[model samples]
Target: MQKTNKIRVGTAAVLAVVLGVSSLIGFSSSANAAPVTINFWSRGAQADFIASVGAEFNKINPNIQVKVTTIPDAEFVQKLSTASQSGSAPDITSVDLILVPYFAKNGVFEDLTSYTNGLSFKSKLSPAHMALGLYNKKQYALPFTAEASVLFWNKDLFKKAGLDPNKGPKTFAEIEAAAKAITALGGDYKGFYFSGACGGCNIFTFAPLMWASGGDILTAAGQPTFTDKNVAKALSFYNRLWSKGYVAKSAKTDNGASFAAPFAAGKTGMVGAGAFFVGSLKANPEINYGVTPLPGATGGKGSFAGGDNIAILKGTKNPVEAKIFLDWALNAGQKFIATKAILPIRSDIAASDYVPQDPRYKVMADAMAYGKTPYSVAYTPLIADGQSPWVKMLQSAIFDGKIAAAQAAAQKQALAIVKKQG
Candidate 1:
């Protein structure tokens, strides 16, 4: 095979493919052999799933071994940035879709377009999934899983609220009325649950409500749009929920877990969650729950796209073998799909018997169409920083009944962020 660059990148930027391999002794070999050991890294609770996938890959090609490293998600960006700066990054890495633009722009990864040339990309993935790898027209990352936010409701709780378990509300007004009904009959019950503490999940899960209402945090060119009327309107909607006591006040610091607990414990009627939530629910055999698409805002559907991305790191000694690894990893038959908790990225693979037999599996596959992820270079990591102010804005307006000032403050803070990013 011809020598070329085979590094992978994250979402939104174009990746360039060039032919060349490093002369590093540990990674380059005449063949896939014991001499070659590829280093890789990832963060988040999903590390177990990734490790399982890597293990499956090794079973098929024992010669090229992959050494996996995991760091807590809270420290992921810090560790990855430090490693990248010091030239100690692994041969492969799991990059967040939002972080891809920043990492690729900073020259932290190699372009992966060439390596993906002979593989079946289109038939395997959805258009949105394919778009995650395009950074400025270059291909850097390959989509490994399809994730989306959905409305998960406790069937038992819904029935208690005098609503049909199978037929949830279809519009925002209906949702509001339902929430009021649920709250009116409250005894350790909440109509809606969302995180005022976790900006990463909140931005995706809640921002879509605004997007569906026809507003966005930023434009494609990376300018502020938080002042848009639709944004104010959406914020007002959530604010009403908070004022009506339909929301859990504990959301102030809980991020993802707090919202999950109330719903999981059967105390709350509805919570917005991702495909992974299906697995979480399955683990609890006692909770009888049903999921539906998030309600449309003014007659349109929207939600955040959530998933991990796979990429080859720069400075690797074997481009060819890495390509083989990526192609094989994307195969529909990999054991990782069933055994691991992550859902498959390929639509064709998602439809296969290996994944389709389970009833809850269908919702995981359906979420891709409803999910939308941010494309900003630095916006991703900022979500985790306490100073981001997204949660406080929601609380100020919704919980405190200060809609006008809250909207203005949120817009100011959001614009400041965009300007700082510039």
Candidate 2:
């Protein structure tokens, strides 16, 4: 049986332990004349989900209310940086997971080793996400939401192309062959689709191929290794498909805007995307889809674990209220996310906890387990920046067929950027 209790002022509240899952919080309530507000800043792309989570949070914790601010993804880093430097940072923020290392390195977030260690699900949290939130052995954040880049195949299109609708490609060759067969159907039938000109999108989707094939573009210490053979193979994989005209033309020009339109409309056979893709296509039940972790050229599978990490800012005045919210996030908060059809932070969450939802969630979960993220303090300039060498490298290799030149230039540019960060 479950019990309910309203948290009171200045008293330590023990979060109810339920279903073998538990969390501990001993923070005293904020001694404020006015009701304490926990300002939670979430990126615009994630604002809707964050707003829903905020509403649920207010329901149980009557003493504290989370104020959510939606910052456009394009301006989040700049706005947050300005706020942090001027000593006006939000009580807590959900930052892009890949940028966690960058923020931690720059001392933008509070050290949460003590708090994170207390959470029971800390051990079960996504490893890729946990690793990102660490800097100098100090934990700065906890995964708020998880998004794993996995392969999405249109099952109906597969059957129409004379392929098995149930079986998705497990290797690059299989993917290519599937594309060929699908493309043979001619008019508007795309075999494989990609955001050829989008750096972030490519890294989210394409880098996993290199990872699966035992190739990595960065050393653990934030050094660039872009000239690896695995990277060449991954880029060449797209080059082969593009050269054969099996890829959609939109791919060459897509700079991340509406990249999924082709695939979601059931015209494209295979593409790489994340959980948000499922949410976007939810209204279109007309298309039968199947998902798998991105596969290597020969056989291995992997994904880019991308999404947001929740961390209390370094100078928050409402530490107690902020921590109370954080504690709730690790338990009930995760349950809330599951209800929204988003992936939970904890790997151990029961299937019953999530929406009786897409059966393909298992694929996303496996991808999360199998995935890894690049750890670098120079992440913005190296990968996420619009003008980064990564996008140019992909374009040069995939579209211009300048693999050697592209690799050399990218390596040199990457080294320069990382050196500047040092």
Q: What is the TM-score of each candidate against the true structure?
A: 0.86, 0.90
Kindly list the per-residue Cα lDDT of model 1 for residues 318-375, writing each as its tens digit. 7666666767767732436655556677776666643565666676567676567767
Residues 187-223, model 2: lDDT tens digits = 9898999988777788899999989988878988889
Sliding window of 10 residues with minimal summed lDDT for model 1: 11-20
> What TM-score would you give candidate 2 relative to the actual structure?
0.90
Best candidate per lDDT, number? 2
RMSD of each: 9.1, 8.4
User: CA lDDT of 374 in candidate 2?
Assistant: 90
Span of 10 residues, lowest total lDDT, candidate 2 = 15-24
